[model samples]
Target: MNTVYIGLGANLNAPEAQLRNALDALSKSQELTLAQVSSFYASKPMGPQDQPDYVNAVAKLTTQLSAIDVLDLLQQIELQHGRVRKAERWGPRTLDLDILLYNDAQIATQRLTVPHYGLCEREFVVFPLLEIAPKLTLPGGQALADIAASLPHNGLTAISQYDEAASLA
Candidate 1:
């Protein structure tokens, strides 16, 4: 099985509810087993400030699928929750599911990239990721704690926590 980490964010159509619905969809997938989920946080938008802030969280899972397959699954989940592909980079969306890491493997293709393109500097991702694995190190050997220390908190505030045991079942 491949251990994977997923980053979740939503800022439209009842953001928190969209996140929970996406989590439930992922937990029900047969190809993967949901492990732990981090507490939710709300942060300033990464793109144009004219948009609403995002609700973000991270999830750790064990999957039997390949990197591309996992990306495909994530896209499916996003679509199910009303995510549409817009040309605006980092624009607001109904849901965003990114494959942060896939068993520490570095994968780069036109469709996806692991160790997600902008993870190192994003407090929203790093902080939530730390909740599940404080000692995590990327495939490049960068310690997560070290990365966290390097970045500013960036106004991310916890909105809610997840109960792993309750959600796992």
Candidate 2:
């Protein structure tokens, strides 16, 4: 199994609950083993400010599925949650799952990119990612903490956490 990091974000339709549901769906998958989930960090919208703020978090897992397969699953989940793909970049959505890293590999396919294209610059991604894996490093060899520390981290606030007890019920 390959270790993978996934970034999750939502801004529509009960964003927090949507994130929790998505996380549950991932955990229940037979091909993937959910490992660590960081607390949700509420952050300002990355694109048009006309929309709502996003609740973001990071999830680490071990998966037998390949990178493309994982992307396919994530897309399916997004669609299930009423996400509609448009021409707009970083638009509001019910759920956004990004493949941040896939076992230290740099995968660039027609449909997906591991080490997600914006991992280093997005504070929403870095902060939650740090909470789950403090010592983690990107494919570029820079320490995760250093990258996170370098950013101003403005407009990001802790909202909630992944609750083991509630998830178990």
Candidate 3:
């Protein structure tokens, strides 16, 4: 099984519930084993200020599926939660699930990018990632804790812990 970290974010349609429901979906997948999950976080949107602040968190899972397959699964989960793709970047969405890392492998393809292109720079992504895996090092050798220390929180705030039972219920 390959260990993977997924970044979850949503700013619309009850954002926090969207994330929790997504987590429940992931846990129900037969090929994926839900592992550690960071506390939920709220942060300002990365692009347009007109959008609502996002609820974000990082999830760790072990999966037998390939990286691309995992990406497909995440996208499917996003879709089920009412995500809509548009031409604009960083626009508000009902759900966004990204594969932040895949078994320490560096990957680049038309469909996806591992270590997520914005992973180190986004406080919502980096800080919650640190909360779950404090000593993690990027595939390229950068220390996650160091990255967290260097990156500003950028108005990110912890909202609540992940409650698996409540989410699944």
Candidate 4:
């Protein structure tokens, strides 16, 4: 099984509920075993700050599924949660699931890229990812904490505490 880290976020509707439901769905997937999740954070919207603040978190998992399979599953979860791709970049949504890392594999495919292209650029992703996998290193050899420390002051903050007990239940 490969250890994969996925980034989840949403600004529309019940953001926390969407994240919880998505995690629950992932936990029950045939090839995925939900591992750890960082605390949910409310971060200012990235692209256009006009949108609502997003609730974001990072999830670590062990999966037997291939990268493409995992991507497909994530997309399905987004669809189930009412995510729409028609909006402008970083627009508000019901849920957003991004594959942050898939083992140490370096892959650049038409549909996906391992070690997501924007992982290093977003404070929302870096902070929560560091919380869950402090020592984790990306394919670029940078530690999670190192990357997070390098991010500019972008107004990212841990708004909602991750309900660890409820998530595990």
Candidate 5:
């Protein structure tokens, strides 16, 4: 089995609920097992301040599927949650699911990038990821704690705990 970390974010259609529903779906998948979840966080939008702030979290999972297959599954879940293909980048959406790390593999293809391009700079991704895996080392050999220490909070705040009421199980 391969261990993967997924970054989840949403700023539309009840962002928290959307994340919960997405987590539920991931937990139900036979191909993957949802192992750990970070606390839900609210953060400023990355691109375009006009949009609502986003809710973000990171989840850990163990899966038998390959990275590409995992990407496909995440996209499917996004579509099921009403994600639309948009020409604009960082626009608000009902859900955004990204593969942050796939078993310490550095993947770069037309469709995906592992360790996610924004993982180091994005406080929303960094802090929550640190919450679940504090001592994690990135594929590039960078310590997750070191990355977390360098990023400012950027108004990111933990809004709620996962596996409590947020999982929607």
Candidate 6:
């Protein structure tokens, strides 16, 4: 089984509820087993400050599926929760699920990238990732905690703690 990390975020229509629902949906997937979840964080919109603030969290899972399969599954969950891909990059949305890492695999494809290219740069992704997998080492051998500490993350704040056992079950 491959241990994967996923980032979840939403800023529109009961953001917190959307995140929780996403977690529940992921937990129901037979191909993936939700193992751990980070505390929810409230963050300012990164690309467009004009949009509403976002609620973000990260989940650690063990999956028997390939990278492409995981990506497809995530998209399915997003659609189920009313996610629409607009022309705007990093625009507001009902739900966003990103595969952050996959068992230290280094992948660069048109559809996805493992150890997500933007992982080190975004506090919203890194902080919660650290919470769930602090000892995780990226493909380049950088620890998640060290990477998070090196970045500028003054805007990320934890608003709610998620219980892994309760949320996954």
Overall local distance difference test of candidate 3 = 0.94
lDDT of each: 0.91, 0.90, 0.94, 0.88, 0.94, 0.90
> What is the C-alpha RMSD, rounded to one decimal, of candidate 1?
1.6
Clashes of 6: 0
Model 2: residues with Cα > 4 Å off, grouped in runs: none
Pairs that collide in candidate 2 are none
Candidate 6 residues 133-159, lDDT tens each? 778888898777788878877689999
lDDT of 5 by residue, 32-83 (tens): 9999999999999988999999999999999999999999999999999999
Best by TM-score: 3
Predicted candidate 4 versus true structure: per-residue lDDT over 20-129, tens digit per residue: 88988888788899889898888888788788888999999998899999999999999999988984787889999999999998889999998999999998889899
40-82 per-residue lDDT for model 1 (tens digits): 9999999799999999999999988998999899999999999
TM-score of each: 0.95, 0.96, 0.98, 0.93, 0.97, 0.94
lDDT, model 3, position 142: 92
Worst 10 residues of 5 by lDDT: 160-169
Q: Write the per-residue lDDT of candidate 3 for residues 1-169, one digit (tens) a residue.
A: 8999999999999998899899999999998999999999999998889999999999999989999999999999999999999999999999999999999999999999998999999999999999999999999999999988889888899999888877777
Per-residue alpha-carbon lDDT of model 2 for 57-150, expressed as tens digits? 9999898889999998989888888889988898889999999999999988788877899999999999999999999988879899999889
lDDT of 4: 0.88
How close to the true structure is residue 17 of candidate 1, measured as C-alpha lDDT?
Answer: 84
List clashing residue pairs in candidate 3. none
Better of 1 and 6 by TM-score: 1
What's the lDDT for residue 86 in model 4?
Answer: 83
lDDT of 1 at 135: 90
